[model samples]
Every structure is written in structure tokens, then in C-alpha cells.
Target: MSLAAAPFTSLPTPLPAPERTKTRLLELIKRHGPQTAQDLAYKLEVSVPAARRHLCDLQDGGLIESRTERPGGRGRPQHVFALTDQGEASFPKTYSGLCVDVLRHVQQLFGQGAVMQVFDARSAEIAARLQAEVPLSAPLPVRVQAFVRVLCEMGFDAVLEQDGDTWLVSKRNCPNLTVARQFQELCVSELTMYQTLLGVPMTRETRIACGQSTCLYRIGP
Candidate 1:
């Protein structure tokens, strides 16, 4: 046997960037909250009309919905777009579907700590990504906004609101709500990530895994 001819493990073929972008759009809506055509354009680095046309296509396919924003100020009402439930379903979530069964098996073979260790690893990865994107020294609101932006990028539909000394962070969808419901550890890890990323104490008031309409959090609690 020629030791020099080492066996190579095959890697999963990557999806084309264009195809990836289709799903990415769904994720962007899921995490970033609703976005305008202009916002999508900037994110996609495409022309405004092109982005509008693409969003229209997604809308026509029943993957997205466009609603006129309540005018806070200025000229025409901007049309904000968000993912429909169907759109949220189109994103890649192969693990969540079988999370309960998988975790149960893992617990049988190893221990519950193994399942939690898995969640902790995932949370650490997400936290590191967010930390790199948003500095901890930035102002609190900006950090919150940065966290929301990161959530959007990760495919969450996240928004930030301020009331007095508290900042309300809400996510409209959970990519892995099924797994989160089966294993609350996932939820805990995500909350820990949020606390780390935003650098402020937060309390989770609502959880989609718990049948809430949104995952609502109050910062500075």
C-alpha cells in the first residue's frame, strides 16, 4: 500500500451562490425583521429595482409578505417585507426536524450533558461570530441593534425597541423551535449568547418553543 496516497473524506458539495442567496433572503427576513426594498438591495449588493423585483417574486411565490409601514415621518410610506411562515419553512433545517429523537438517543448513549454540550458548542460559535461583528465597547443601543442585525443575518426576524431604560428585543421566528421545545437547553444557550453579545442583562419573556407568538426579551432587567 502506498502510504503517500492517503484517503480523502468527501465533503458535501456546496450549493451555488445564487441558490444559496434564495435561502439567505428568507433567513435575512427571519432574523433582521421586516426590510424595505432598499434595505434588501444594500444587503444583496444589487440594484434597488432588481431587489424589488426579486422580493416581488418571493412574494408571488407566497414566501414573503409586504406591508406598508406606519409612517413615523417624511414622505411616502415605505413597504416593509417580511417572511411568511411558509418562507421561514423554506430555509435549511434538517436537524431540527429530528432533534427530539436525536437528543433522546444521545442521552441514552451518553448523558444529558452531552446534549447540552452540543448546544453550548453551537452557542459559542454564534457568540463568537456576533462578537466579531459588533464590538462590546459600542453604545448599548448600538450593541442591541448590532445583535438584531446579526440575528437577521443568521435567519431570525429580530427587532429592537426602546421603552424608558429598557430595550425590547423580539424575534418573530425560531429556525429550530421544534428542537428548542424538545430541549430547553437550546433556548438557554441562545439566551446566554444574547446576553453575551449585547453585554447587558436580559430576561426572556416569551419563547416560540413555548407557543408564544414571538421570542420577546427585555434588556436591562
Candidate 2:
């Protein structure tokens, strides 16, 4: 199996050395499944002792576990590291199952209109907070920058760009993706919120809930 470590750009910058190594270790195990300490050390280019130390820490933190495996069912035993449930959750996800369950209950109790109202209220609340943080009277580009900043703060992997005369805002990660899949009213509420906040017409080109890689919105003329 290829032991090449994949590039991860989403890790927060300026991570401390030991923490960075541990995080990478988790990523490697997550991507490659169970890996021997020797393999992890080789992949990380760290000494076996160092790798073992990190593994111990992860095990203590309940992120990874080790199991003894014998090569060819007869060779000497070696330990392999695998991610625990906690470790798997360290990665990003599009939606929350708990949130989905709560929404299901809400729908069952109050009907679809109430669900729509929930999203509408949520959109308004988020829009109000963003408006307070990013002045609506500011220039469109400035507001766009603030919008992206606010989205990032709220756990959305959002970016802003200028496409000729138009501005494009793309969200690469959705914090409530699964919820949106079940409640498309969430997407509609989002568009309405953006227009209300920007005070300009906007169009959604693609939706993550609709199977697109990104939720793309086109703003400006």
C-alpha cells in the first residue's frame, strides 16, 4: 500500500510542532487505516521513539488504538495504529446527524411550514449578526470580504472573488449540509439572507446539498 501522506491545507496555521505531528499522525491513520508504528514513523520521517510517544499520547486521548498483528500469520507481532471514533470525527463533515434528528422532530410536531419558519428565523438571526459585524452601508467589495470572514468564523469554508463585473462567493464546506439536504428551505433562506444583507440581487449557481462540490453564489450585476 502506498504510504504517501496526502496534503491537508485546512489545518490551522502556526500549529505547534508536537501538535502538528500528532494531527498529521491522526490524518495518516484515518486515510490509510491501521498503520504500524514503523510505517507511521517512516511516513512522518520521525524517529520510531518519537512516533511511539505520539501514539501513546493519542491513545491516552482516546483518538487511536493499537492492535497486535502478525505478518503472514506466523511472523513476529507488530502493533498497528487505527483511529478511534473520536479521531474519525476530527475531520470535517457536511452535516450533523443530531441536527437532522432534531429537525425531524420539529417537522413531525409542527409541519413543513414550521420547518420553513425555523430556517427563516435562523437566516434572519445570522443575517442580523453579520450585518452588525459588517456594516451594510459599506462598499459591496468590503462587505463581501466581511461576509467571507463572518462565514469562516461560523465554520463555513467560504471565499470571495471578482469575476469581471460580478462577485462570486463560494462555500467549499457546509456546516449543515445534511440538514439542508432534508430541508431545502435552508438553502432558500440562505439566498434570501445574502440578498438582504448585501442589499443586492444574487443567484445561487450550485448547491452542496444538490450534489455540487461547492455552494456557489453570484452577486452584483
Candidate 3:
């Protein structure tokens, strides 16, 4: 008997009927990074208003977010919508699992020292990139703002907010919470990173790992 070769696979499987339009729209956005309603309309071969309606429905469901884009020599700034972390969840991912496994193996094979070194090295690299954007000579508040933007762009769901007299820098959602919890060193490195980046008196007001709602840091004298 002759053996057959393995079958080819396609992403996300497929859906039928009314779900098809929404699913296809999401997939188009996912494949093309971010796109405006007009662009999405052209891609989907649907009218611009219809595309906007679909996008509105998706945004209402918390699948995407609208960001204002200032084009060069533009008549007006336009809004481009992109998938939020929640929206991206509809897609497949393997990186997080692989990262945890790799770190665990490193700790087991070498030692906790090696794992700490890994985190430290990673933090150092991140700090360098952040410093380039924020500048070390900038004011503490300015530096905190820059770092918050960087964290959000890196999928940390970070934001800087003012709470009464304090400026609070918080990561609303931790991208690597599981790995950080398991390693613990990751958490220490994160605090050290903030201190090194901001060059000001900062304290952790709350931490997600410790059952707090948000991972908050107080930045000021």
C-alpha cells in the first residue's frame, strides 16, 4: 500500500453566512496591519459607509481601536482602526508558550542566575531603546510619558495618569504576566528598568502579580 502525504492547512478555518463578512473583515485587517474604513471598504469591495458600519460594530465589541493618523500635507487627519490585543486574540499565537518553555528550560539547565542574567540583559536593551526616545536629560514626567508610550506600543497596555498629587505610570495589562510570575526576577527587572529610565524617586503602588487591579508606579519627588 502507498502512503499519502500530509494535508495542507489554512488559518482560522472558515465560517458561514452573516458571520462570514465580519470574519473576513477582521482577517483583512489582521493581514494588512491597520487600515482605514475606506481602505477596508475597497479591500472588502463594500461601500465606505457599510465598511464604517462594520468597523463601528467591531469597535463596539472591543475588537479594534481607532487612532488618528496625520498624513503628510493632508486635508484632514483621518482615523485608522487597528486590532486591539483582544481583537488579535482571534488569531493564533505560539510565542508566549514557547517563551515560557524556553525560560523554564534555561533555569533548569543552567540556574536561576542564568535566568536573571537573561532578564537583565533584555531590560538593558529595552532601556537603551527607551532612553533614545525619551532622552536621559529630559524631566522625570516627560521621561515617564515616553516610557508609557513605548510600553503600550510593545503591547503592555500601558498608560500614564495623574492621581491627585501623584503621577501614576501603570501597565493596565501585563504582556508577560505568566512568565514574570514564574520567574519573579522579571518583576524585579521591570522595577529596576523604571528607576533606571526615569532617574527619579519611583515606587510601586500596586502590582498585578500581587492581586492589584493595575501595575501602578508613583513617579515624583
Considering every candidate listed, which one attains the maximal TM-score?
3
**Error in Å for residue 118 of model 3:** 0.4
Alpha-carbon runs more than 4 Å astray in model 1 = 1-94
Residue-level lDDT of model 3, residues 1-221, one tens digit each, is: 99898897878866774467778789998998778889889988989998888888889999989998766647688889889999999899888778889999999999989998999999999888778887888876677788888888988798878877668888889888778667788988888887888777688878887778799888876
Clashes of 2: 0
Best-performing candidate as measured by lDDT:
2
Which of 1 and 2 is ahead in lDDT? 2
Error in Å for residue 8 of model 3: 39
TM-scores for all candidates? 0.58, 0.58, 0.60
Q: How do the residues 1-221 of candidate 1 rate in per-residue lDDT, one tens digit apiece? A: 55687799999999986566666677778888888888878898888887777777789999999998755656788889998888877767676667788888988899989998888898998788668777899998778888889888877899989989999988998878778888999999888988888788999999988888999999986
C-alpha local distance difference test of each model:
0.84, 0.89, 0.84
How would you order the candidates by TM-score, starting with the best?
3, 2, 1
**Reference-based TM-score, model 3:** 0.60
RMSD (Cα, Å) for all candidates, in order, is 19.2, 13.1, 11.8
In order of listing, the candidates' clash counts read 7, 0, 0
Model 2, which residues run further than 4 Å from truth?
1-95
